[model samples]
Target: MTRVISILFWLSLAAVLAFITLPLLVVVAASFSPTATVTFQPFEWTFRWYGDLLSNRWLDPFLTSLKIATVVAATSGVLGLLAAYCIVYERLPGSDVLMSYLLSPLSVPQIVKGVAIVLFLSMIGFQGFLGTPALIAAHVVLALPFVTRMVATSLANFDANLDRAAQILGAGKLQRIRHVLLPMIKPGVLSGVTFAFIISFNNIPLSVFLVRPGDSTLPITVINYLEYSLDPVMAAVNVASMAFILVVIFLFEKIGGFSAQIHGGSK
Candidate 1:
């Protein structure tokens, strides 16, 4: 009976993996299809759709999304680190309340948040802030909670003894933070920053309302393009976008050694 149960469990896991991966595999295949219509035949593959990606129509939105996501990641990482330091290390009064307030955005529906931001901005007569500037602010609000939580967890597991030792050795507050605390928490910070970039890059609901007509994001651009046409070029665009994000993540991991940090965090 035990053997039979184990076999079933393995089979179930395989089935789930196939379910999740098959559609992506199809999209990848479709991206290379020569015809406008999707074709799975191996002989029909071509790179023309990928070539289309270089055109201004797609490149503009891709660059815009990249810029926005980059800013969001950098800004959120710094802000999240500060918030975590205050809550965890300082043990500020009402820290729990502050932490909850910081994370409140996560609980609210993203559509509601987007709507609320737009309405508030309008009410304040900041109607001119609708495009890139407002989009960055909204994305920061969406991403900040995740970054704060990640940094807080790292801070919770941090060794205060290291900071104390640094102090005894004549290290000042800034030195201790710079050499000791920052090094120890580097993984969490990188993880949060990566999450911020991915979140901002892939966001649709919030971005839909926030993007200007000429300066739409990649995801929004893809969606708008879909309304008029359904072709293999769309698939190519998605495949290229995913590849770009993967490259970004790979570069980050190489720079920060995030895997090692994650391993240490697990222990």
Candidate 2:
């Protein structure tokens, strides 16, 4: 029975992987196809569609998305670190309640949040913030919970003895936090920041409501283009976006010493 279960687990894992990967493979292939119709034959593949991505039509939205995602990632990282430190490390009164409020956004549907934000903005007569500013704020709200939870988990698993040793050696609270706590939690912080960047970059439901006439995100632009035509350039755009995301993750992993941490944990 155990052997049978093991076989079933492997089969299920393979099926799940194939489900996730097959569509990406199709997109990559379609990006290289010579025409709108996706072709599997390499001889028919061309880089012409990729060349179209250089135009302002695509570049403007890509830049907008990049800017928003970068700002969201940085803001979420810093705010999450502070919130997690206060709630987890300090354990102040009503910490649980504060955490619940911080994570409340996650439980709400993103579309509902988007609608609410729009209504709130209109009511407050600040509709001027409906473009990039709105996008950044909404993304931060969506991402803050994930960042806070990851950092909190890291803090909870932290070795208290290290802080205590630092205290004994005449290190102050700020110094211990800067040297010991921050370094130990760096992995979780980076992971949260990376997640924030990806989600903000690819977000559509929320962005659809917030985007203005001249300022739109890449995902929104891709969707609007799809509404008019079925173009291979869309596939090329997706491929490039995926490549950019991979590069971002690689850079973050290097900065956070993720590989070293993994090796150390294994040992």
Provide backbone clash counts, one per model: 0, 0
Error of 1 at 147 (Å): 0.6
Candidate 1, residues 1-267, lDDT tens digits: the string is 999999999999999999999989988888888766655555655999999999999999999999999999999999999999999999999999999999999999999999999999999999889889999999999999999999999898888888899999999999999999988888888989999999999999898888888988999999998999878899999999999989989988987847967678423
Best-matching candidate per TM-score: 1
What root-mean-square deviation over C-alphas does model 2 reach?
A: 2.8
Q: Per-residue lDDT of 139-211 in model 2, one digit per residue for the tens?
A: 9999999999988987887889989999999999899989988888888788888999999999998999999
Give me the overall lDDT of model 1: 0.91
lDDT of 2 at 135: 98
Q: Scored by CA lDDT, what does every candidate get? A: 0.91, 0.91
**For candidate 2, which ten residues in a row score worst on lDDT?**
258-267
Q: Which parts of model 1 have CA positions greater than 4 angstroms off?
A: 1-9, 40-42, 265-267
